[model samples]
Target chain A: MFGFCADPDTLGNVAWMACYLTTGKHMAIYLSVGTVLLLLAITAPAALAFGFAGASAARSRILPLSWLGRGYIAVVRGVPDIAFFLFFVIALDQFFEWIRHEVKCPDWDQPIRQGNDFVVCAEAKLPLGNAAQWVHETYGFFLAVLTFAIVFGAFAANVLYGAMRAVPRAQMETAEAYGMSPRQCYWRILVPQMWVYALPGLSNLWMVLIKATPLLFLLGVEDIVYWARELGGAKTARFTDYPHGDWRMWYFLALLVFYLLFTRVSEIVLDRIMKRLTHGQATSGGEAQRKAA
Target chain B: MSCLQTIADYGLRSIGIGERLLPREDFTLCQQFTLIGSGMIWNVYFGLIALLTGFFLATAVALGKASSNPLARKPSEWFIFVFRGSPLFIQFFFAYFAFLSLKSVSPIFDPFTSAWLGAAIVLFLNTAAYSGEIFYGALLSIPKGDTEAADAYGFSGLTKFRKITWPTMLRLAWPAYTNEAIFLFHATTLVYFSGFPAWRQKGDALYYANYFADKTFNPFVPYPILAGYFILVTLVIITVFGLVNRRLNRHLPQESRGRLKMRMNLIR
Candidate 1:
């Protein structure tokens, strides 16, 4: 990244450190932070949408739809979400490949599950066998995103459902008296008013989502945790230019500091958001706002 | 082999007692159920011990946070902040590496280096912080009237705390505490994934599930079985906590008493 980074091995002290920090692997580490942020940006709204759908379905008038929604919420609530994360990535991958296999290989006679291997046709492989290296990485990242959305979506659903219920019954009655339709009341009154209640839970969820980004490494994405482990391991002279003893402790410490900083910033932002959401509202924060104003 | 035989062979497999090698090929429903069910022993072990131990520490931390002195208040506040601020996954890795380094420095601490001690300590501290926050919230929300009534009756210090404060705190915090307990159980799945290495292939449910997934290259069987086992464990936790919640509220009149509603808010 700098002109002085030409010879990392020959340079001494500050120069060596400068070159080492700008190595290609370090660039990947920097990029992985972007990956974590991108994941948060994408998954937040996606999970919110999923949660909205879930909350709505749970409140549906139809018995089966309501049951289906309630069941979805209940099941996810009961199990450890990491189990779902581990389950869904592989299950979804196989489900996709199996679908593709049926479509792409009509003449193939061998069973897809032969003994231990999931032998999908070559064309049916996710990202395909011939895809670029980036495709594979991106595919894994996408799966991680999906897994995150699904797990956190259930949590968001629980929060949003509670928030939706917390919307004053009298307000709904007033909307009815005004001759507004159920849908209009839902969209205009309930949804708008619910944000004040939801904001607290949603902000908490955002912190959790931010913290959860490291689990992307478990999903096979070369995330910050992956990079930390890769870069911080004892590098022998046989393997690389800079040989060092096991520095995983330091790497994890760096990750811990990074997360602590991220969460602290998030706390500040979420507090501001709560204040904004509560402005002139009837909640406790709103009372403070009124007093200040 | 029959289901009974499968159970006998793999029931203690997670503890490294049964089959030398995990079933690799020609997987069956019985095998999936048995092996995953066996793996759940580790999850339950981790959750129960952590929750049991964390409960007391959480109470203390909650009290510390609510203390009049800044000396008590500050450390409790920082403890909650540090643990609650970071992900449990990172906490596990941070803890494992920290323990590993400590083990290198002093071999006498090898017991602490193992997953059982290391992971439990992390979980204990993690859950304590989370539950401490819940208890702190409950403490703040304790009715002023109740405390004044206790003061009016000449109750002071430990007597005031025992008679008026602690019970109310427990009652008020019970619902949120239930959520924390559930999440803590869920967090046990993370133990093997963190920096801690499983000795002799002894690990939690997700670890064994991952093992089968890798071996079979077919995730369908093992993962669901693992999920089912967890779902059962979760149900048991809910039932037990619900019983405790009921007992906590038993003193109040039926109309005034809060029901033990299972709210799935993620505390961890």
Candidate 2:
């Protein structure tokens, strides 16, 4: 990152530290934070959309749709999420490649699963085996995002479903008496009012999502956890210019501090948002606001 | 080999009891199921013990947090804040490395560096913090009239807590605690992935699943088998906790008693 970063061994104390921190691997570590943020930015809305559909389906009058939604929520809740993460990434990947194999290799009739191997054709390979490094990285990241969205979506669905139910029956009845259609009342009144109730649960979920980002390393993504483990292992003089003893403890300590700071900032922002959202509702926070004014 | 024979050879593989070497080639479905099922023992061990132990500690910590005394309250508050503020993944890594460092400084501490202790300690602490928050919420929501009634009858401190506060907290927190137990079981999959090395192939469910996935380059079988085992364990947890919850709230009037509703919103 700086001109003095060249010849790390020759550099003095502060300079060596600067160069040490600016190594190519360190750059990757910094980039992984961006990856974590990018994941949050993408997964939050995707999961919200999934949650919205799920909540709507769960509330549906149709029995089968409600069952499907209920089952989706139940299955995810019943299993450990890490199990789903490990399962879905592989399962989804195979499902995608299997579909592609059927489409791209119509002439090749041998089983896609021969004995123990999952041999998809060259064209059917996700990101293709010969593709650039960036494509592979992106593909892995995309899978992680999808996995996160699926797991957190179940959680968000539970929250939103509760929030929907918590919307007072009298409010809906009033809307109904005012000549509003069921759909119109749902959109104009219930949806708008439910968010104040949802905000607290959603804020909690956001903190959880932040904490879960570290699991990206387990999905084969070169995330911060991966970088910390890679860079902080004992590096002998033979292996690299900057010889260091076991520093994984320090690296992970840094990660711990990073996460604590991240969660703290999130708490502050979410609290502000909660206060704003509760400004004029019938909830306790809303009533407190009115009394204080 | 027959499935029974395969089970006999590898059913205790995760604990290094029967199989010395894992099947490298010619992996079969039966082997995957047997070995992965064996690995589930560790997951169950980690989840069950942690949840059981964490329950009492969580109750105590929650009570401490709700106490008027700053000496008791402050430590409990800080404990929850530290554990809840950081990611469990980082906690595992930090703890494993910290244990490793301790082992070097004192050879007597080497046994403590093992996964069974190190991972359990972290999970215990992590779950305690999470369930502490839930119990604290439940404690706060306990009806004032119940406490007043206890006071009117000369029930105070320990007696009051035993009669009123404890049961009410357990009843209110049961649903949330059930969710916490489920997530902790899920978190057991993370033990091997963190800094704790799976010595002698003695690892948890996801560990063996990953091993099979790597050897076969096919994740379709082993991972799902692990998931199945976990789903079964989760159901068992819900059933057991639900029964306990029923027992806790058994004395209350039917209309007055709050039902044990599973809310899956909170994650720790």
Candidate 3:
């Protein structure tokens, strides 16, 4: 914020706009975009890890593990993801808090669920009741990221499962002919080759994951959507530095353009990545590139 | 009240036919089930209507995009890109505000502020763009032999399309289109969550589920009920689409007709 922003009311239109955009709240709102990016950064790898585990579990020789993996993948088959986002935030929160309640409040006797209220002991509250405000927000964001990771992990698993199966049987057989164990074949041959198949699905999933970041607001994180609504509302003359009528439409429009640009950039980047990954592979994409060369 | 009476009262509550006020306390499983089931009507309404209406628009847009004409192709391409690129959630919010802003200038645009019309239009356009892209891809893939055969029969333009090109496109696009419909249904949950306000507490299944979750502070129960309802709905869509897929592929040789497997990874 510039020093001239000290008296925003008298500034010209351009100066006022500059001061308005650089307000502390606006800075927080700008940082909320980072919150979204950070969420995507965090959730992408977490979901991939979860997906890898789920895919491996499904492909396992053990019956129970396979069933559990299959169940996890099937969880997304029916329900809308927003439901899971909403459900898991509470369900996961309670599960953790309830665990803490058991450990931290062994002497407490009251039921955790008292009719309508979920009255966990004070000590069991996430981030502890006495913790700083930022700690509570961080806890919420962690839960939301976990929720995103869990839900999208199922989708990633579904994609990875197909990619794993799509790895031609001949490839795996040849690896076996070399006397490599199943595990070695899986890691060396199948895993490396699966990326070519998975890239398309994974790229699409990445797009979905990017789009889903807005739902972080519903999880109570002060993400872009939250900030947009907060900052873009009609600000009365007396209440704020610069008075503005309903500017939510403009705010949302900005978000729309931001998303459009993000997706466009992602598409270009992913296309290049796809080309890079497909090289020397046996898939159609690879086959075409070989022919082109 | 008995479960039967409660159902009779709250069964149509989502549509505002019965039960002026939702249950405040001591929520029963029956009430959660009934209300959430009632709320499902909105989901079905939004999904079916959007898909049906979008079908025609998608067909046109697909053709337009496939056209060699720059004028027709450019707008069609841009429409698809804009809708397909961004999040539907943001689209709803942005569209709602856009419509709200319009309410001042033109009285005719007043009703666009409501969820039923405003949100439905966004969902409809959103789906059309997606399906259009799918259809356009399928359209391009229609075997040259088939079109050559149509030309040999002295058929051209719309005649060739209605009889030959259209059926093949639908058949080819059917599997992906099924996935599109599934995602569209899942997307209807965002309507209430976005800027569109649910009038008189009337909302889709997720809305009622969220409500019960908030009130009872026990999300484990209601959300699962919502999920169960959705799973059934997904099955119904798949079955209906599967039958149509069969009819479209009726002329194809037996082995060539790919079975309709519900693949989970759909572009949202």
In the range B155-251, model 2's lDDT, one tens digit per residue, is 9988888888898888888888888887788888889988899998888888888899877778767877887888788778778888898898889
**Cα-based lDDT for every prediction:** 0.86, 0.88, 0.91
What order do you get sorting by TM-score, best first?
Answer: 3, 1, 2
Which sequence of candidate numbers ranks them by DockQ, best first? 3, 1, 2
For every candidate, what is the interface RMSD in angstroms? 1.8, 2.0, 1.5
For model 3, residues B38-107, the per-residue Cα lDDT tens digits are 9999999999989999999999999999999999999999999999989888999999999988999899
- For all predicted structures, in order, the TM-scores are 0.94, 0.93, 0.97
Provide the lDDT at A151 for model 2: 90
User: Would you give the TM-score of chain B in model 1?
Assistant: 0.96
Worst 10-residue stretch by lDDT in candidate 2 chain B? B259-268
Q: Which pairs in model 2 have colliding backbones? A: none
Chain A: TM-score in each candidate? Answer: 0.94, 0.95, 0.97
Two-way lDDT contest, 1 vs 3, winner: 3
> For candidate 1, what's the RMSD?
2.2
User: What TM-score does structure 3 among the candidates reach?
Assistant: 0.97
> For candidate 3, lDDT tens digit of each residue in A1-293?
99999888789989889889998999998898999899999999999999999998999899999999999998765578889899999999999999999999999988888998998888888889789999999999999999998988988888899899999999999999999999999999999889888888889999988888889989999899998999889999888878898899999999999999998999999999989998998878889999999
DockQ of each: 0.65, 0.63, 0.70
- Candidate number achieving the greatest lDDT relative to the actual structure: 3
Question: What's the candidate order when arranged by decreasing lDDT?
Answer: 3, 2, 1
Error of 3 at A29 (Å): 1.4
